[model samples]
Target: MLDAGLPVRAFFTDRRGGHSAAPYDTLNVALHVDDDPDAVAHNRVVVSEAAGALVTFLEADHGITVARIDEPTPRPPKADVLLTTTPGIALAAIAADCVPLLLNDPQTGAVAAVHSGREGLYRGVVDSAIAAMLDLRPSGAGAAGIRAAIGPAICGACYEVPENLRARVGRRHPVAVASTSWGTPSLDIPRAIETRLTELGVGPVLRHRHCTFEDTRWFSHRRDARTGRHAGVIVCEGPVGVSVPAPEDAAT
Candidate 1:
């Protein structure tokens, strides 16, 4: 787990640590990937156990909707952004090649996990999330004090897209406009995301350089269709107590 540099605890999950088998091999936290439901449950338990907090993971639809988690629940909502100020609960966003963003405001101790895919980014997921985050803060709060982490995802060189699609996204996000290694039009999502964060006044942004499509340690749907998904999780310290067997016990 790489440190997110936020005031709260944060980390990005990879493919090496769960009970899933084959393409979803291990550490697949997503419930809709057609993996064994039992295995997914075990995986979620393991993740929550390790954090000593209740886990609330978003079921992303690649849209800009938001879900507010005041406490841990049996079912997390379907949204692109999950936010909570409650302590002792974790907020997570699952993804394979799409970007999983962990955001936190140290001053307010409010944290959020966001799913920023190409469509969501094009449709303003980042802006929506930041707006919601600010709403949770004081009257004058902005994103200047928010700490953010960008997890592994398909790189620009590997995310080839049609010209019109690139143009559509580029018209708003010029930094997203990119060319693949072989010279086809592509979208450098991570880079574009970092640029957006910088533009938003968020500082000291932490970004992982791993490309999901190029790194076997990370599950990549573009590289291996029907593959599993990993997640970006943020656990805040609070009063709730939740526990279960550790991941090692379930992964085997």
Candidate 2:
């Protein structure tokens, strides 16, 4: 939806559409996973072309770092989430088994992309992103207009966690804890994210129903340790001063 007039254009890419091979298969977008740099670059181009914007990549390390799109220079800031008020620039975060969150303020046209796995979740990426968005667009006027979408991830049924992890997740999102097939505890990352968004007063929360682990169509690092990464991308719609045509028109 990048070309829409809404404040943000956002989408989560699956593993089915790129050029890669073997353990990484195809469409692996992560440069950190030991995938060939050429393949990764090609994959990134595919994502950008699909999103219709030049997506700025962020190095996510399970920490919170806020970035503005208008900045001329890039610094070494590692964060699991990135936010921007500037249009025409898209922000992207990477994930494999983790949860990717896309947020938008339709009124102000600001957006953010977040990568939150168990560690990032523990670090409060959701809370941090909400705080950053609110700070950029203060007052309930802009905050209340925010919309969020929680993308594909490892489902709780397939996401077995150790007792320590389970306990930590339970502390923040008790409802996400569930008994696993082996009778161990697991955490629903998406559920935790949804709860956090509700708590932060996000207007609408849409969830993708696919489980990366169970669905071979998507990449799952937990299921296959050598798998490539997928990206969640969001950008402000269109080039400066140029209106994007309606979807119906584009289809013609």
Candidate 3:
């Protein structure tokens, strides 16, 4: 597990130590990847144990949709961003190469887990998540206390893209436009996310240096097509199941 360097109990999981077979390997938490269902269940239980609470792993739609979790449930709603203020209810964002971002506001004890891919980034999923978190803030509260953790992902040096594709994403997030080590067009998604967080006044952003594509310790879908997915989990630890009024748009 990769520590997120925040006050809350937040960390990103690596693909190690669990009950899965080859391809999916061990510790694959994503059930949709065709891994053994019983094994996936066991792996999820392992992750929850690591989290010290039951984790609500998000199901990504690869969009900017946001959902608020008020209580633990058997099935989590499908959304790119999952927000929670209830204490002891952990939220997780599952990904391989895509960026798994965790956010927390010390002022309100609100936290979010975001699954941001190329499309989600281009479509402003990061902004959506921050907005959702801000919406959870009390009246007149500001965003100065919000902190972020960017987990392992495909770095710019390895995330090669077409020139046109790079141009397309660069139009909005210019910092994301980059060149791979081999001198080809690429996108630095993690760096771009850091920049966005800074722009949104989120301080002390901690970004994990490990690149999933280059590091064998973490699972990379680009490196292995049928690979398993890991997660970035953040725990909320104040109260439990207290319903904070959510914006209408937060519904999944």
Candidate 4:
């Protein structure tokens, strides 16, 4: 588990220490990836155990929808962002190449786990999550003290896209416009998210510099289509069903 460098019990998982067989190969936390159901269940329990709470996993749709999780449930809702002010409820965002972003508000003690990929970013998933988090704050409690952890993702150095697609996203997020190491049009999603957060005043972001496409430790769909998924998890500690940040997933 990669600690998000936050005071909370938050971390990103690697493709190690799991029960799933090859392809899904160990520690695969996703239930819809055509992996063995029994293996997926075991992996989920393992992750939840590591989190020290039953986690509510988001079934991402690559949209800006947000869901509030106050308690554990048999079925997690479908959304790109998950928000909670409750403790003892760990939230997880599963990913392969897209960005897994975690947020925590020190003052209001609210937390948000956002799933933002190229499509979601274009659709404003990050903005939706930030807006939702601000709503959870106390009266007049603004975005100050709101911290973020940007988990590993495909860096611009390797993420190549079509010229038109790159131009489209670049129009909205100029910082995202980039050229890959191979001189192809690319989008640096994590960097763009960081810039957006800073512009919105939700700062002090702790970025995990390991690129999923370059690193073999984490899963990367772009590297292998039939690969397993890893996760970024955060659980509340202040009170049960009460406070902290959480996680969600995004499709590539």
Candidate 5:
């Protein structure tokens, strides 16, 4: 678990400590990756244990859609962003190479877990999530009180892409445009996200420098095609007494 630098309980999961087999190995939290259903459930239970609350794992649609979680649910709606203000309800965003982003508003106690890929980042998922978080605050609340954490993902030095694709994403997010070590066009997704977070007025943005493509600790789809996925999880604390529910079936 990587510390998210927030007051609440928040961290990023790696490929360790669970019930999955090879490729998925252990601690794989994604259900859509053809891993064993029973194993995935067991892994989710492990994650929930770490979170100390019932987790609402989100399904990423690679878009800017945001789903609000008012209570703990086994299956949440398909969306790239999951937002919740309810305490004791943990939210998780699973990813292999895509950025697993976490946000928390200390003032409002609202938190969000985001799956930000190239498509979702270009489509303004960060902005969408920030807007939803601000909605839970006072009428004039700004993002200054919001804290963001960027988890492990494919770094710019390894994320080689076609020139045209780089140009397209660069048009909107110029910082995303980068050159790989071998002088090929690439996109620094985490760097671009950090830039966007600052541009949006969020503070204390904590970023994990671990690259999934380079580090074997985290899962990377680009590094291993049939690999498992990790998650960025955050818990919304409330009064003690609410019980956590069981994990659900594999998500489609």
Candidate 6:
């Protein structure tokens, strides 16, 4: 877990250590997948227990929907990102090959979990999330204090695209257009996101080095079309928060 001085703890879970079978394998956190519902629930329970809090799960639909910490419980909203300031309210987003972006305002104790895939990128979902966080921040202090982390996903070397899709993504962030090992044109989704973050002046961006497509440990939607989903979770923590457990701690 990365501590951003916010009133929460956040971490991205790769595809490992859960109770699902076959293509879903072990650690599939997505309940929407055809995987056993009981297994998904149990996986969430395990994550919540590890965090020492009750986790509030969301069904992500790759749109811009913001949920407040104190709202009447309704069906999961179709949002690519979820934000909250309430302590212990875990804001989560699911992805297989798409990028999961986590943001935390060290001063305001507000956090956001964003699912930015090709469509979400095209729609400027990440920019919207940053703007929303700025709006939620306390007076005077702006988005400068916000720290962000972009977790594992398919890298440009493994992400191929046609010229049209390339042009579309490049229109937003030109750095995405580059060559790959296969001698084909590819889009570096992470680079595009980093460019956007730079444009937004978001502080201290952490990019994970792992690629889901290359690493068998993670669930990749493109690599396994019918595979289960992995989750990136963020939960508000108490003033005296507990330490985040290491990967080995939860390997069992």
Tens digits of per-residue lDDT, candidate 5, 1-252, equal 787766689999999999999999888998899999999999999999999998999999999999999988888999999988788889999998899999888777788999999999999999999988878766985677577889999999999999999999999999999999999999999999999988897876778899999999999999899989999999886423322222331111
Better of 4 and 6 by lDDT: 4
Q: Per-residue lDDT of 146-249 in model 1, one digit per residue for the tens?
A: 66789999999999999999999999899999999999999988888888887886755778888999999999999899988888889866322222223332
Candidate-wise lDDT, in order? 0.82, 0.74, 0.88, 0.85, 0.88, 0.73
lDDT of 6 by residue, 116-235 (tens): 888888788888889878886556545664667787789999988887888888887788887677988788888788778867867656677578899877889888899987777777
Q: What is the lDDT of residue 204 in candidate 5?
A: 68
Those runs of model 6 whose alpha carbons end farther than 4 Å from true positions after fitting are 1-7, 71-74, 138-141, 238-252
Per-prediction CA RMSD (Å) = 7.4, 5.5, 6.2, 5.0, 7.5, 5.7
TM-score of 3: 0.93
lDDT of 6: 0.73
* C-alpha positional error of residue 198 in candidate 6 after TM-score superposition, expressed in Å: 1.9
lDDT minimum window of 10 residues, candidate 3: 243-252
Kindly give the stretch of ten consecutive residues in candidate 2 with the minimal lDDT sum: 243-252
**Tens digits of lDDT, candidate 2, 1-252:** 122223456788877778888788788888788989898888888888987776777778777666566531233267777777776777787788788888876555668888888878877888888888777554653345567778788988889988888998788778778766668889888888887787777756677767889888788888888888887888765223322333342110
The best-first sequence of candidates by lDDT reads: 5, 3, 4, 1, 2, 6
Superposing every Cα of model 3 onto the true structure, what RMSD results?
Answer: 6.2
lDDT computed for candidate 4 = 0.85
What's model 6's TM-score?
A: 0.87
TM-score of each: 0.91, 0.86, 0.93, 0.92, 0.93, 0.87
Q: Poorest 10 consecutive residues of model 4 by lDDT? A: 243-252
For model 3, name the residue pairs that clash. Answer: 87-239
State model 2's lDDT: 0.74
How many collisions between residues are there in candidate 5? Answer: 1
